[model samples]
Target: MIAKFLRDPFGLEDAFPPLKKWQLWLAALELEPPIFKTDVLSTVNDMAGMSGKDKETVRIMIEDAQEYSREDSRIDLLAAAMGIPPNQMDDLWKWAAQIEPI
Candidate 1:
């Protein structure tokens, strides 16, 4: 489920093949405002417990996802894939807001 959800918009599974549980949790976590409060950097830093090189790759993936989310149809696609309510996608954006540059 999560694999397909992330495939197109984020290509996450590809970026981290044999995707671990934490990666999926990170996806879900990115949608939750209160939990992931800061931005993609925090998400990468907090959840990506990987080497510096791997972390950079994950960061690039996240940056790409954020850029992709700008299109409404893409947002709907992602929201549906992630089981997020269409109406609440704005809230998801709130969580994804980049507080500062990495």
Candidate 2:
């Protein structure tokens, strides 16, 4: 069921083999406000145990989020994949707001 949802938009053929999760997440952060919040939150939650390069990647993403504005469809797709609700997405943004950009 979940797999169907994740693949519905981007397709599940592995044709693009999702760029490292962090990269994808970072891309999402650059998206429009709602999507940015949702993706960043979902990514951080899904990759909770992130380490090494992943951690560094997320830090960079946080920094990027502090200074960009665009729409990222990937984030919307990811939020759907993670089953994050719209309202909660705002909380996610608030969490992101607390992070000091590097």
Give one digit per residue, the lDDT tens place, for model 1 in 16-79. 1222323333545754352332343564565444678765665554445434433435345445
Candidate 2 backbone collisions, by pair: none
Ten contiguous residues minimizing lDDT sum, candidate 1 = 13-22
Segments in model 1 whose C-alpha atoms lie over 4 Å from true places:
1-27, 30-66, 99-102
lDDT of 2 by residue, 1-102 (tens): 687777685653322222333444444465554345454545665665656576456545544553421134434434554456654543444444444434
State model 2's lDDT: 0.46
Whole-model lDDT per candidate: 0.46, 0.46
Model 2: weakest 10-residue lDDT segment is: 12-21
**TM-score, every prediction:** 0.34, 0.28
